[model samples]
Target: MPGVIARILRRTPDTRYAELADMRSGFNSLAAKVQTVLDKDPYGGNIFLFRGKRGDLLKAFYWCDGGLCLFAKRLEKGRFAWPRSDSGVVALTTAQLSLLLEGFDWRQPLDAARPRTAL
Candidate 1:
């Protein structure tokens, strides 16, 4: 998770890993299928992530309190760097998920653009 997101979820339980699956499911569909198919409880408070076939869209499923929340993101320029495995599930750390969401390659998220001099 990024700084902002990390802070927001600071007190929340540890959701260190996100499940990456090749799914084009909507809110209601995912909420119903993820638990049984993936064998994961959506109400368990872990983050479940899914990517589109085109590699341009992403959806994150999370359980907050008693309800489920879905977050969707799409890249306008470059496609998101998705895992190259076949149709299956991949577990990613929070850091990797954050980089992926920002359009950066999660495998190599390096950005050293700090200012050398301060005014």
Candidate 2:
């Protein structure tokens, strides 16, 4: 499971939708966009991530287990942190993706407290 997640995170989507409602689109429509607009295979097993204009909702589209799967997340208290660029792909590590999904700043994650002394 970790290996699969790692592999998927290594391949970031080339495009991102600006509206959350747009992500509400069905599989066919999303697949069409992925095919025509991005010129990428919708069934190629790459994960595409989309964020809403308000940054509170996020959607992930990918091909999985012989079919397509769409996963969505909506934050209740805080908005998701996203890249400033409205276009192009953004590569992320597994940890960064996890942070993004958890509504944290993936670019500069909060530092952990250092050990007071070596054991």
Candidate 3:
């Protein structure tokens, strides 16, 4: 399942966010906002991410399998890391998106320590 998500993200060129969005919005409203506010095609093969004003909630809108898909998450302990810009599209890589979803700082991820020997 994880591999599938990685593959999908790799194939997708546009993983973008609209800075802040209304978390109460449903699929139709988000689709409309994507079309009107961002000047983007709602049905286009791109992942659109939205963060709530409080910063703890996130919503992802995309087209998949002949239907629209919406994925939402709310951090129990911390807020999702976001870009500095207030309004506009912020492109993110698959790794960055994953880190952001896990409530980590995608901008400056700490380097993992190298192992002394390979097993």
- Candidate 2 residues 1-119, lDDT tens each? 32344345445543333333485687888788777766778888777777777878887788876988887777888887876545555655556677777777877757899999999
State the displacement of the C-alpha of residue 88, model 3, in Å, after optimal TM-score superposition: 1.3
Model 3's alpha-carbon lDDT is 0.82
TM-score of 2: 0.74
TM-score of candidate 1 versus the correct structure, residues matched by position = 0.68
Name the lDDT value of residue 63 in candidate 3.
88
Model 1 RMSD in Å is 4.9
> 103, model 3: CA deviation in Å?
0.9
**Cα RMSD (Å) per model?**
4.9, 4.4, 3.1
lDDT of 3 at 99: 81
lDDT tens readout by residue for model 3, 4-114? 443554556678888688899999999999998888998887889999999999888888779887878787888888888656887888888878877888888788999
Residue pairs whose backbone atoms clash in candidate 3: none
**Candidate 1: tens digits of C-alpha lDDT, residues 1-119:** 33444333333343422335456677677866666667767777877667776778777777787777777777788987876545456666666766777788877657889998997
**2 or 3, which is superior by TM-score?**
3
**Stronger candidate by lDDT (2 vs 3):** 3
